[model samples]
Target: MVDGRRITRRRFLQDSARAASALALTAWGLEGARGTASAQELSFPVERGASLRVLRWSQFVTTDRPIFEQNAARFTQRTGVPVRVEYETWTDVQPKAAAAANVGSGPDIVIGFFDEPHLWADKLVPVTDLAQYLGRKYGGWFDVCPQYGYSPQRNAWIAIPIGAPGVAINYRVSWVREAGFDPDPARFPRTTDEFLRLCRALRARGHPTGFALGKAVGDGNTWVHWCLWAFGGRVLAPDNRTLTINSPETANALEYARALYETMIPGVAGWLDPHNNRAFLAGEISLTNNGISIYFAAKNDFPEIAQDMNHAVFPVGPVGRPTELHLFSQAYIFSYTRYPNAAKEFLRWIMEDTQYARWINGMLGYVSHPLRAYTNLTVWRSDPKALPFRDAVARMLPHSYAGRPGPEAARAMAEFVVVDMFADACTGRRSVRDAIRAAEDRLRRIYRS
Candidate 1:
């Protein structure tokens, strides 16, 4: 984690008070057909000589970085705003953003993942004007899009969600058939019981699967949350105030995670996010949970592996429904930005169909659009392997699992409470009861004050 991102309660309340003014201007109405903010209303004219810097996580699909840099250069070409793009690991992105948000002195815009905005919405500029403008120009956002960035206290978006990377099972078709399971993507294992059996068969065939069990902010959290929700467990009460992580359903899920980890290749209890990506690419395993980045990596570097590998929906739980955790790609324009209008202008340019479509094509299937209209981007339909993930952003629930998001939900995600619970049980670090109790205790502290 980036150093010094933690928020003390006194500091947090202070920032929330400071953050209210930005929201107060547009707080009157946020839901249903609202009037758009014109370039004139958002105020500052695009400062011609202004320079804007955006800090973002390193690209998931790898190839998108250079393509994005090229796009940034093009943005500068059209507008006079000079742009500099910086990259960080997914693990480092939020903390760095937190550091910047608290200090009010970094990145004109920063890439935010999980619930970063929820944690520091008070410190970030409201983007409702920009969001609504984009919605009017390019069609509206998906139903879930606003929740990731919306500030109920302010009644505005803390950040405009750009997109999300959907988490799903990435399996080798050839290996599945070799292990005596149907290789057909359409007929792949749909239930948790069938998924477990297939993993056993694949393991016996010497292609054991694994997922990151360490504090992988994205991969570990997404898969663990999926398992927990699949088994009828959730992290928060409907109130978003009470901690509901310790339950019989949660224990059942933990038990399932323990069994699932046993089917994985050894040493997964120590793996990080990139470790499994490297493992799968090295042909060390047959199946794992991941986004389309793995697919692009295989296609670009290991064509034969690409041919063998394909995507599948996250397996259904015993509850007869599947739960997917979408790792969102959201960017915030900081309140401290000197070039607010220029920064907003740059984002608007980036969202335009021509610019955004080109960028989406370059990413392959790594990111799905936050808005429903952009679902027609054709990147998914062009590649059959990517089609399964087209609806990732549309189907996601908040990390808190219930009710509106807040600092409490964001803190729970950043702390990786659910992930640690499963890892504790799976790795023998703690019994299920002890693990759940430990998680509950930690959450109590997070939700306090």
Candidate 2:
């Protein structure tokens, strides 16, 4: 929690107003004049010789190289400064960053999933003064972008959210229709019981449900968290300092997950994240929990499947609330870099409405933006095929929750809790109750240590 003294409601409202003003100015074509003045106020004046070194995810850097390069070129055109990028995978990024922070030799900026903030907090330079910087530059920060990467305790901006991927139930429209069920939202599952009955009905017709049960990190972690949320359980307490998975809600969630497993495709227990995508592509599974990445993959690589693919919000639980929506808003910035201001400026540039749209459209379905301004852009809103995803984003954005934003919490989740108990529960090797208890125990030990 943030210290009450540092974040009074008066200050929050004031900052929000400034952010709104900045956004309005940007929309009104004051980019160069406004940004320059703002930049001057925030930093020691853009040194004509100043440059930036940034670290980013390899896949995005590679595929979107041209777009980013063009954006970089434009930035140079506008500000007479240059930006350099170094890219790596999440697996390789941490060790390299840790080594750099150890030796004081890291890049100025870093891009990573939500887990990155918690993993690299010590090295990070809090932009809690983000309002100050924004107030100086363009008059304010963009309202929506800040929600993606703020740490209340540190009272700082850790990273800037570039894009978001939201979780939903992906299903084969034709298969569901053939099963004599309407896949429309109005007819969607309203409770766990209804979801199970539907899954059974699909299986009885020979279309198996599938989930990521493989040993891979992505699939395994997603399945565990989604189930935890859907069952009214949580990975940790609201303060994000304790693992409370042993509650009745958590046990029930696990039981619900186990029930889904029973109707999953044959050998699904052996499937990993990639395999889940393959299973869906091969037409062996009718439904699964997935994100825009899979939907985009289908749309681009397998058009036929994409044509048949449709997504719906996760089912509600017996408790009357809907499934927990897990949203991954990819953020950028690394603390070890010598060029924090430059990196921040670059982030600010990309998050602008114009640049944001280009990045979103170029992702070809790999990314989703959560901001209402971006989603309502003419490109996404005007397209019929994009409507389902657009609507899903709108509906799920409000309820979305992220994992703990601290290194200890992240390590516990990645190394102990997610990898262990979730695997055990899905394979029927442990009951939901036992899994939650064990996870909570492990997490307690992690927190204490």
Model 2 Cα lDDT, one tens digit per residue, 1-449: 26656787888999899898766445422233234342553433455477887676655312366776678778778777788877775456656766666777767766665455656566676654443444334333333344445555555656555554556678888888887778875577767788888898889899999876655444555556656676667666666565566678777777777788788887866665567777887888899876556666776688998888777766766656644434445454566555666666676677665676676666543455644345455546554445545533344322223334556555664563754676678786787667667877777787777
The residue pairs in collision within model 1 are none
**Across residues 149-267, which tens digit of lDDT does each residue of candidate 1 receive?**
67887667778788888887899899899989997779999999899899989998899999988888778988998999999888788887777888999999999888888779888
Q: What local distance difference test score does each model get?
A: 0.81, 0.62
Judge candidate 2 against the unseen true structure and give its global Cα lDDT, from 0 to 1. Answer: 0.62
Task: State every prediction's TM-score relative to the real structure.
Answer: 0.89, 0.78
The candidate scoring highest on lDDT is 1
Model 2 residue 304 lDDT score: 91
Q: Count the backbone clashes (under 3 Å) in each candidate.
A: 0, 9
Q: Provide the global lDDT of candidate 1 against the true structure.
A: 0.81
Q: After superposition, how far is residue 44 of candidate 1 from its true place, in Å?
A: 7.0
Please give the distance, in angstroms, between residue 107's alpha carbon in candidate 1 and its true position after superposition: 1.1
